[model samples]
Target: MQRKRASHYIPTSTMELERLYRLLVLAILVNVVRGRFLPGPWIYAAHATFYGAEDAVATMGGACGYGNLYQSGYGTETTALSSVLFNNGLGCGGCYQIRCVNSKYCYPGSPYITVTATNLCPANWARPTNNGGWCNPPREHFDMSKPAFMKIAFWRAGIVPVAYRRVPCVKQGGIHFNLQGNYWWLLVYITNVGGPGDISKVSVKGSRTGWIPMTRNWGAAFQVFHSFQGQSISFMITAASTRETVIAWNVAPPSWKQGAIYMGGQLG
Candidate 1:
C-alpha cells in the first residue's frame, strides 16, 4: 500500500477557516450519500507544452529511453516525447495520459493523448530565466511531441493546462528482450513494458550463478559481468510504478544472436 505524505499549511484569516469547515462538512455528506468507496490511483494536474523532439536519435552520448536499435522516424507521430524528470532513472520508459483541462487554448473536443517518456528536458541551471525547456517545475509537467500536443489543443496556442496520470503502454505485441554483443560480453535491453512501465531493477540468474544484479547502463540496457558461454539465463524484471515482478525463465539461451529479440510476457 502507498503512504500519503502529510502536508501542513499556515492559516490566513477567519474566512479561510470557515471555508475549510464548509469543505469538511461537504466531504462527510458526499461520503454518506455514496456507499462502497474504493481507492484509485492518484492523478496529477499540471501545465504542458509541445516541441518536435527526436531525442531517441540523439547525436550526443545520451541514449534514448528506448534501446539503441530504435528507428529514427518510425511511429514518431505518436511516440516522440520528452520529460523533465530524466534525472530519476525510473522515469525513463514510462507512459502517461495527458488531457487538456484548463486555459483558453483547451477546446471542447480535446482528447487525452498517451505518450511514452523518451528524453530528459534541458535543465535551466545555466540560464535561471529559462523555464527548463517548457517544463514547469514543482508539478508533474510534460513536454510532448507536436502530434500529442495538437491533440490536446491547437498548435497556434503554445501551452495548455493539463491533467495527467500514469497509464499502461498499450503496444501491439508482448515484451521484447534484446541481447547485444556476443555470448562472452552480454548486454540486455528489455522493452514494451505495459503498465506504468518504468523499469526499476533488472537481475539475471544463469545456470551456475545465483541472481546477479545488473547495473543500469542507460535507458533499458542494464549491464552485468558477462561470463555465460553456453548456459541459459532467466531474468527478474521489476516494474517501477507498481513494484510488480515478472520473471522470464530461460528467455535467452547461450549462443544468443546479437540483436535477437525474445518475446516475454508483460506487466498488466
Candidate 2:
C-alpha cells in the first residue's frame, strides 16, 4: 500500500476565503509601514534658477564647508538652497531630485536631475520677493548650477517652476573627513555621506578621552575646541531628518594632518 498523501489545505467557504484575503492584505500593509516596501518619493513644489557658468566654478566652496566640488565628489550637480530649505546649514549635503514643470522653457520629456545641496541662496531684502528676491523667506527655491539647470529648462527662462523631492544620496567609496584647524581646535568637514546625507549632530572620541560633542561650525563642518592629537579619532554622526546614527571607528590616526581628507565608513 502506498503511503497516504497529505491533503493541501485550501479555504472553501466564503467566510474562510475572505478572512484569508484580509490577513494577506494586513500583512502587506504591515510590511509597507515597516519600510519593507518603499513607495515613490514625495514631490514638492519649488522654483529654480541658475547662478554659475557651465563649468560651475562659482558654485564651489560656498556656504557648505566642502571645498572644491570636484575634489569633494559633488561635481557640477549641485545647488544652493534658499533659507527656507537651507535650515541653518543642516540642509547641507542633502540630495534632491528636481525637474522643470508647467513651463514653456521646460525641456520636452526632460528627465529629473539629482543635485547635492552645497550652498545657501541668500535673500535680497532690497528687491520684492516676486521680482528679484527669489530666495526670500517663505519661498522654496534652488539656485542650481548652470549645468544642472540646463538639464531641465532653458537658461533664458531665468527662473522656472520645478518639482523636487528629497532622495537618498548615492556616493562612492566612504565618507570623507577633511581635517582642519590647529592642535587645540579641530574642525572636521564631512563629505560623501550616504543615506539622508545631511548631518544634524556629530560626536568625536579620542583614544585617550571620552566622547565629546562637536558644534556645527558651518555647513558640513563641525568643530571641537578640545585637542585630540597623538591619538586615534572616532566619530558618531547623526542624520538630520531620520536621526539615524552611524559610528565611524578610528577614522583618523595620530598622524592625521591638517587639510588632509581621510576616508571613514559610509552610512546607508
Candidate 3:
C-alpha cells in the first residue's frame, strides 16, 4: 500500500505580506468607488464682488435657493456671496469659509469670511473693467455682497484671489425654527443649520399624531395642517446634502408665536 503525503502551508515572506496588505487596501477603495466619485468641495480663484438688494436679477430671481441668506443681507453685518461653479450657483444654498490667500489686490491683513451662497456670478464679470465694473472673465469667480466682500478684503481691492472651503453653516446657537401660520396650520422655517445646510424635508409629531409630513412652502419654510396646531410642536428636519434627519423635540410650545425662534443644535 502506498502512503499519501499531506500538503503543508508555505510561509509567506515579509515582502509578500506587504504586497497582500496593499492589495487588500486597493480592493477596499475599489469597493467604495462610487463614494469616492461623489461630489466634494473644489477650490476656485473666485473674484469676490458685492451684490445685494441693489442687484436687479439674481440667478433664481432672488430666491438664493438654499439657506437663509436673508439674515446676512438684512443690513450688512452678516455678509453673503455667490459663486460661478455649478455647485455654488443659485439654489445651491451652500456655505463657504473664504480667505484671501495671496493676491496682488489683497490688502495687508489676511481675513476670512463665512457666507451663504445666494446668487451666481455673471460670465462677463470675471475681473474689474473700465466701464465702472470690477468683474470680468467668469469661471471660478464669486459675486459677493458688499458686506461679504468687505469681510475678506477692502472693497477697493475689487478682485482678490481667495482660498475657500465648504463648511457647515455657522449656526452659533444651533438651528433656528421660526413658527408661523395660524393655529389650524403649522408652519416652520428651518434656518441656521450646519453641514450641507439646505433642507430636503420636514416631519412633525404630536401627542396624538405619529408623524405628520410637512410640505415645502417655499425656500426653507415647511407647512402642515394638523389638529396639534395649538398643542405644542415637535418635528424632524432632513438635510438636503446629507439626507439625515434632525429631531427637534417639542421645539415649539403650544403658544405658537408667529415669529418666535427656537434653538436646537444641528447633527454634529
Candidate 4:
C-alpha cells in the first residue's frame, strides 16, 4: 500500500494573510511619514539666484573652507545657502534638489539639479528684503553657481522661484580628510561624505591615544589641539541629521602630512 504524499502547498489562513498585508501597509506608511520614501510631498518653496562665472571659478575657496571646489569634488554643482539654512557652517556638505517653478524662467523641460551646500549666502542689510536682500532672515534662498542655475532656468532670469528639498548625497568614493595645521593643532576638513553628508560631531583616535572629541573649526573642518604625531589616526564621524556614527579606521598613517588628503571608509 502506497503512503499518502504530503501536500506541496501549505494554505495560509485568511486572518494571517490580512495581518501580513496590514503590516506591509504600516511599514510603507511609516517610511512616508519619515520622509524616506516620498520627498516630493515635502518640497519647500524658495527663490534662487546665480553668481560667479559660468565655470564657477569665482566660487572656489568658499566660506566652507573647501579650498578648491574641484579638488574637494564639489565642482560647479554647488550652492550657497541662506543664513537660515547655513546654520553657521553646520550645513556644509548637505545636498539639495532644486527645480525652477516659474514658467517664465524655467527651462523647457523644467529640469531639476542637485547641489551640495558648500558656502553661506550672507544677508545684505543694505537692500530691502523684497528687493536685493534675498538672503535675509527667515527667507530660504539658494545662491547657486551660474552653471548650476542654468541647468534649471534661463540665465537672463536673474532669480527664479524654485521648489527644493533636502536629499541624500551620492558621492563616488569614500570620505576624504584633508589635513591642515601643525602637529600641535590639527585641522581636518572632511569631504565627499555620503547620506546626509553634514557632520554633527567628530572624534579622533590615534594608535597611542584614546578617542578625543574634535571641535568644529569652520565649515566642514574640525580641529583638535592635541598632538597625534607619529601615530596612525582614526575618525568617528557622526551624521548631523541621523546622528549615526561611522568609524573610519586608520584613515591616515603615522607619516601623514599637512595638505595631504586621505580617503577613509564611507557612510550610507
Each prediction's TM-score against the native? 0.71, 0.86, 0.62, 0.86
Q: Can you write out model 2's per-residue Cα lDDT over 117-152, one digit (the tens) per residue?
A: 999999999999899999999999999999999999
TM-score of structure candidate 1: 0.71
Q: Give candidates' CA RMSD values in order.
A: 11.0, 6.5, 9.2, 6.9
Worst 10 residues of 1 by lDDT: 72-81
Instruction: Write one digit per residue (lDDT tens) for candidate 1, span 43-72.
Output: 655667666544423322233445332441
The local lDDT score (0 to 100) that residue 95 gets in candidate 2 is 91
- Supply candidate 2's per-residue lDDT for 225: 98
Comparing 2 with 3 on TM-score, the higher-scoring candidate is: 2
- Model 4, 176-239: lDDT tens digits are 9999899699999999998788888999999999999999988999999999889999999988
* Number of the top lDDT candidate: 2
Better of 2 and 3 by lDDT: 2
Instruction: Using lDDT, rank the candidates from best to worst.
Output: 2, 4, 1, 3
RMSD in angstroms, candidate 2? Answer: 6.5
Which window of ten consecutive residues has the lowest lDDT sum in model 2? Answer: 31-40
